[model samples]
Target: MADVQSLLDKGSNNGGCQFIGIWGMGGLGKTTFAKALFNKLRFTYEGSCFLTNVREKSKKHGLDALRKELVWSLLGDKESHIGNAIYPYTMSRLGRKKVFVVLDDVNDHEQIENLVGRHEFGSGSKILITTRDRQVFAGIKVVDIYVLEALNPNESFDLLSIKAFKNDYDDMKIRKLANELTQYADGNPLALKVLGSFLNGKNQEAWKSQLDKLQKLPCREVNDILRLSFEGLDEEEKNIVLHVACFFNYYYDAEDVKKLLDACGYSTEIGLTRLEDKALLDIDGGKICMHSLIKQMGKQIVREESLKYPTWCNIFWIFKKSSEILKKNMGSIEGMIMNLSEVEETRVIIKAFRSMPNLKFLRVYGNLNVQLRNKLNASGMMFLSRNLMLLDWVGCPLKTLPTTFKVENLVEINMRYSKLTKLWDGEQNLVNLSKINLSGSEDLIELPNFSKAIHLAEVDLICCRKLQNVHPSILSLHSLHCLLLIDCKALTSLTSNTHLKSLGKLSLAGCSGLSEFSVTSEKQLFLWVCDATINGELCSSSGHLSKINLVRLQRCEGVTSLHKLVDMRTLGSLDADYCNKLASNLCSKFDEMRALHFLRLTNCSELYEVPDNISLLASLRQLDLSGSNIETLPLSIKHLSSLRSLTLNGCKRLLSLPQLPPSISLLHVNDCLSLETLHLPLMTEDREGDEFSPEKFSLINCMKLDGQSIKAVEASVLLAINNNKAIYFWAKWNIREKELQSGSCIGLHSLS
Candidate 1:
C-alpha cells in the first residue's frame, strides 16, 4: 500500500478533472485502482453517491436509465423511471457541478459515448474510466492513464499473508509459506485470495498439497468469476448480452455491428444502450469484449433457454436446426453436430438446406472418390446439375470434374489444389462457367472443355508440381483478373495472349526447369520465387505494381538493374528477402515509395552502402540488413520519421548506429560481433525533444565496442538505453493490435 500522503501529493497538484484510465486484463483489478482513486476523490466530490456496482447491471439498466441514474444520484433523487422526470434536468445540474463520473468496467465505446457523451460538464468533472480494453481510450481525452499491472511476488505474498498468515510477515515460518503460496498464484490477486481462503485452516502439508493442485489451475477460475459478474445482470440486459456474445462478435466493426443488429430487429441504439448501462457489456476500441467467461456463460444460458423453449435449438429425434444467421452468399455454416456422419447429409432431410432450392453461388468441391465414383454414375451428379457458379475443388483428390453433370447454369470454378489425374468434358454450349483453380492438382492431364469458361476472371495453377499445359480457348478469358502459376515445377509456359490488364495477383514462384513466364498485368502482387529467369522479354517498364517479391530466383540472369521496377507508388512491400544480387544503393529513383515499409535484402553479399535519403520514407518500420555488406548508413537515416526497429545483426561492415532517431527504442544489433565503439547518454525524460546530446545512443552485446555500463554512460550524447525491459516496452512502444476475441456466430442471435 502506498502512503496516503503520497497519493494526496500526486493529486490536485495538477489542474482540470484528471482523465485517468486504468487498464489491465480482466482479473488484474483495474476497477480496484479506479476505486482507490475514487476514495481519494471523494472529499473533492461532495455529491458523490458512488453507484458502487454499475458494471454487472448494464443490460438491465439500458442507456437512458444509465444517463438518468447518474444524473438523478448527483441531484439526490431516488425514483428510477426517467419519463416522469423533466428533460435537461440532469444536464443543467451537471453543467454546474464539478462531478466525478467514474464509468467502471466500460466494455464498448458506444456505451461510454451514450452514458457521459451528452454531458457538457465543467473541466474538473472527471470521467475516470476503468476497462480491460486499453485501446478504447484512444481518440478520447485521457490525461493520465494508469495501466494496472499484475502484483509482484512480494506484493502478492503480502496480500496473501494478510489473509492466511494473519498479517504477520515477521514470522519466519509463515513468511516462507507465504512465498510458496505466492508462486502458485502467478501474481493474480483474485486467485491469491481464493487459495489463501481455501488453505487457511489446513496444516502446512495440506497447504503444500493444495499449492501443487493450484499451480495446475488454468483460466477456469477467472472465467467463473466473470460468469458470476454476468449472472448479476438483469434479464433484458441478459438477452442483449447473449445476442452480442454469439451473433455480433465478428461484426464488431461499428457499421457492421449496427447493420447485423438492425437485421436481427433491434433497429435503434436503445438495445445497445440497454446492454451498456447494466455493466454487463462495455465497448472498447470499437469492438465488443464480452468477458470470456461471460461469453461462455451466455452460451450456456442460450442452450438452456433453447432447451426450455424446445424450438430455437431444435432437438427433436436428431437435433436438426434451421438458421438464417450466416452471411447470405459466403461459405459460412451454422449449427454444430455431435458427429458428421450421423447428421443428415441429404438436403431433403434438413429444413434449412431444402427450403433454399435456388442457391445462387454453388461451387464444386469433393474428394477423388466423389468425382471418380460419380463420373459415369447418374445419381451422384444430380445435386450439382443446375444453377452453379464458381466450381472450386482444387485439393479434393478429384480424378476429374464429371461429364455427366451437364451444367444448366455455371460461372466461376477453382480446381487449383485438387489432385486431378485426368479431366475432360467434351460437352459444348455450357458456356456459363468462369474462373477455375487447377493450381496444385499436379496429376491433372486434360482440361474440362474450356470454351465454357469464357468469362473466367482468372485461373491459378500454383504448386501443381506436375501441371502440363493450358488450352488456347482458356487463354481467351479476357476478364481474368488474377493468374497464379507459382511453383508448378513441371509446367512450361503460358498461352500466346500477352495482354491481361485485369490481373491483380500473379505468382509463378518455384518453376525451376521452366524457361519463361510472360504476362502483362496492370496491378499485380507477384511472387517470382522460381530459380529460372522469368520471360526477360516481358519485363518491360510500365503499369502499376502493387507488390513484387523475388525470393531465391538465383537463375534470373537478366534483371541486374531495378530501374525497370515500375509502379513505385502502389508498391506495398518489396521482399528481396534473399536476393544475393541486390547491392545497397541499387534503386535510387523511387524515394517516395511511402507504401514500402518492409525491405529485406538479408544475406545479400554485394550490398555495401544504402542510398542517401533512403530513410526519408517515413512509413518504413522494419529494415533488416541482417546479412549484408553495409558499411555506413546515410546521414538522412535520422530523418526516418517513423522507423521503429533497425536490424543490423550481420552487418559486418557497419560499425555504429550514431545519429539514430530518438523515436527508435529498439535496435536489434544483437549479432553484430564486429569492431565497435559506443557512446551513451541517460535520457532524463520520455517526451520527445527532451534533450538529445551527441551521446544519447548506446550499445548492447557490443563486446568489441568500448564496453560501458549505464554507470559509465552518465555523460554521453546517446541516452543510456533503459536496462529495464518493463519501462522499455511500457514507456514508448505501441502495438497496432492485440490478441482479441473476434469470433462471434451470427445464427445464435438471429430470430425465427
Candidate 2:
C-alpha cells in the first residue's frame, strides 16, 4: 500500500491524469490490492468509481456497456449523455473534475482504452488498473507498473491460520495440517482462503486427505480463476503453456524451450511473451516458471482431454502411459517424456516409434545401470519419427542413429554421453537444425556435414575425446553463434574456409592436439584457446579481430607473443595465465587494446618487465601479475585511474614498489620474499569528498620489508581506524603494539 501511494505521488507530479498498473499471476491478490488502494484514495477525489470483474463484465456486457457504467458511476445521476461518444462525453463532463478510477481484473488493452481512453480524464485524475496481463497497458502512458508478488512464508501461514483456525492456535495436529496446506498453497491468497474455508471444521484425518487430493488436483475455485487466463490464450500459446507445465517448466529455460517450440513450427517468441504477459508463466533469470497450481491446472486440462479422447493425448509425461504408448505404437501422442531408469523389466519395443508418426518432442531419461543399458541396446531401437523436432535422449545405447530416421524437421538433437560413433551416414537436408549437443560422447569420432544447416546457432562437442575434426561445412554457417570444442584432445585443427559472419563465441579449450586454429569471424566476442598446442601466431587473420572482447589462452606454452591481439581494440579481458613461454614484450603492444580492463598473467615466469606504455590503458581495472618475475612496476602505473585490484601475490624476485593509483582498493603482495620498498596511495579526497584508502592491503611474507614500509602500513591502518572505514591489513608480527592498540579494526591481522 505504501508503494502504491508513492507511485501515486510520483504520478501527480507528472501533471494531468495517471494510470498505474498492478500486475501478477492469478490468485496473487492483484484485485485485492487495487480494491484496498481504491478505498483509501477514493474520498480524496471529486468523483471515484471502482469497477470490479472488468474482464468478465466486459465479456458479458461488452465494452460499450462497461464504458456507460464507468461514466454513470462517476457522474452519479447527473444528466449527461452517454453513447459511442463516451470518450468525448467523459472529457466534456468530467474534464474539470478530479476523478479516481479503478478497473479491476483487466486482461485486454482494449478494455482500458474503450473505458478510459488515453489520459482522457481531467487534471489530477488518477486511474488504477489491476490485471493479470501487463500488456493491457501497451499504448497507454502508465505512470508506473507495480508487480504484486506472492506472500512470504510467515504471511502465508498467518493468512491460513486466520481462515482455518480463526485464531484458535492451540491444536498441534490441526496446525501441522494447516502448515502443510499452506505449503500446498505456495503463497497464493486465493488458494489459502479457499482451502482454509474447506478445511475449517474437518478433523486431522480429513485435513490429511484433503492435502493428498490437493497435491493431485488443484482446488476447483482456484483452478477456475487461473484457467480463465489459460483459456484466453490462442492455440499456440496454450501449447507453450502445456509444454512448460508438462515437461519444460522446471527442466529447461526459456531459450531451450524456444528452440524446441521453434522446431515444432510455433511462433515461440510471441507465444512466450503472451504467456509471460498473462502471468501464466514467468521467465525469471531465464528459467520458465509456472505457479504450482497453474501447472497443476494445465496438466489437469491435458488429463481431462485425454480422458475424453482416450487415444489422442497431446503429451504423455507419466512413465507408465508413455511406456504403454511406445509399446502399443500409439500414433496420437505428439510429445512424450519417458524415464528408462524406472522401467526395470518392461520391454518397450523401440520399433514402435515408426507407428507414432505425429510424435514431435521425445525426451528419454536413460538408466545408469550397465545391465539395463545393455538391455536397451539389445532391444534394437531402429526407428524414429522424421517429424521429431526435439530428440533429447541421454545415454543412448545405439552405436549409430537409425538410417530410417530422417533429419528434415529436427531442430535440436541432444544425445549427451551416448555410445554413438556418428550422427548419420551423410548430410541430409538439415535446413531446420539449430543446435546439436553431443557432449561427453567419448566414442564419437566424426560429424555429419552441416552445409544444409544454415540456421545452426550452437554446436557443443565438449569432451568428445575421439572426435578428430569438425566438418568444413560448419564454416559456412552464417548463423552459428557458439561453437564449443572443449577437451576434444584428438581435435587437431579448426580452419575455416569462409567468414563466419554471426559467430560470437568459439571455445577450443583443452584441445591438446590442436596445433592450428583460424577463423574469419570478425564478430566473435569470446574466444577460448586455453591449454591448446597452438604456437606462434594465434590467428592467421588477425586484422579482422576488432570486436573480440574476451580471449583466454591459459597454458598455451608455444604462444610467445600476443602481437596478434593488438588489433582487438574491443578486447576487454585477456586471461593468458600459465603462458610461461611468452616473451617479456608480449604485452608491449597491448596499449592498442583501449578497452582492456582485466589482464591476468598468473604464473607466467618469463614475463620480466611491464612496458612503460602500460599507463596508456586508461580503462584497465584489474592487473593480476601474480607469480611473475617482474621485479618492479612501471612508474607510470600510478596513472591507471580505474585500477582497483592489484594482485602480485607470488612475485618472489627482488623488487621495490612504485607509487600506486588511488583507485587501487585491493593490494596483495603476500610472498614478495625479496627486499622491497612500499609506496601506498596517499590519503586524498575522492570525488564524493570522502577520504580515499585501499580497502585491503596484504604483505604477509615480505620478511625483507624496510622499516619505512612498515611505518607506512601502520599509518594507513591508523587512518582507516580513525575514519571508521572497513579495511583489511596483513603484515609480519614485528609491528608496534602501542600503534595497534590506538584504534582497533576488524580485518587487521598479524602473522607470527
Which one wins on TM-score?
A: 2
The residue-level lDDT of candidate 2 at 444 comes to: 97
Give the local distance difference test score of model 1. 0.53
Q: Pick out the ten consecutive residues of candidate 1 with the lowest summed lDDT.
A: 724-733
Question: Candidate 2, residue 384: CA error in Å?
Answer: 3.0
1-752 per-residue lDDT for model 1 (tens digits): 24322433344312344455666555667667667777876678645535444455566767667766776767676553447343565556666777777888776676676776655665556677776555456656644566565688878887887777677455576567668778656577876776677666567677667756543333356657556545654554455566566434432544434543453345436655545543445566766655433455565555555445433332111222423321132122122112112323333223333332343333222332343333433233344424343343435544655665556455545556666775545754556544456666778765555665656666777677776666656655556666677777776665344445555665666766566544445544454544655544334323423234222344444335443443555555555645555434345644757666766667777777787768657777667777777766776777776666677776776775555655564556655556254334322234344233221122434445443422223332223233211112111112122221112211111111
lDDT of 2: 0.79
